[model samples]
Target: MTVTVDEKRCIACGMCAYAAPEVFRIVGSASTVVAQPEGKSPRVRDAANGCPVNAIRVEG
Candidate 1:
């Protein structure tokens, strides 16, 4: 699976970064997508769901 964050929709609350720092990060006060971990969809989904602005998206 692949994870993406819509920079426009992101609030930079650090939810994704908190939930899955390995796949996401708060850079320059904004949420940025990092390397997607292998076989880590569930964790990514948790991060996405935790996003208050729903800025995170997961794709297969």
Candidate 2:
């Protein structure tokens, strides 16, 4: 799966990192993709859904 974070919309809430630490991390004032999993990950989806600003995007 491919995971991406919209830094412009990110608020550094850390929800993505909390939901999928393996795929995301808080960097500076936004969330960044730390790892791209090989396939669709439930945690990634959760992270996307949990993002208050909807900055996380997951695609397969």
Candidate 3:
């Protein structure tokens, strides 16, 4: 799976990081992908869904 964050859309709310610490984190003014797991992770999906501004995207 591949995970990405849209810098323009990110608001540094930290919800993505809070939802999936292993895959996302708050860096400076945005959320970034810290690790890309080999497969689909529930936490990753949750993080994406939890993003208030819909900055997180997940693809397989």
Clashing pairs in 2: none
lDDT of 2 by residue, 1-60 (tens): 788888999999987888878888899999999889767788789889888988887877
lDDT of 2 at 30: 92
Model 3, span 1-60: residue lDDT tens: 899999999999988888888888889999889889778798889888888898888998
TM-score of each: 0.88, 0.93, 0.92
Candidate 2 weakest ten by summed lDDT: 34-43
Candidate whose lDDT is highest: 3
- Candidate 3 overall Cα lDDT vs. reference? 0.88
Off by over 4 Å in 1: none
Clashes of each: 0, 0, 0
1-60 per-residue lDDT for model 1 (tens digits): 888889988989887888888889898867998798788567789998888988988988
The CA lDDT of each predicted structure is 0.85, 0.86, 0.88
Model 2 ranges off by over 4 Å: none
RMSD value for candidate 2: 0.8
Among all windows of ten consecutive residues in candidate 1, which has the lowest summed lDDT? 34-43
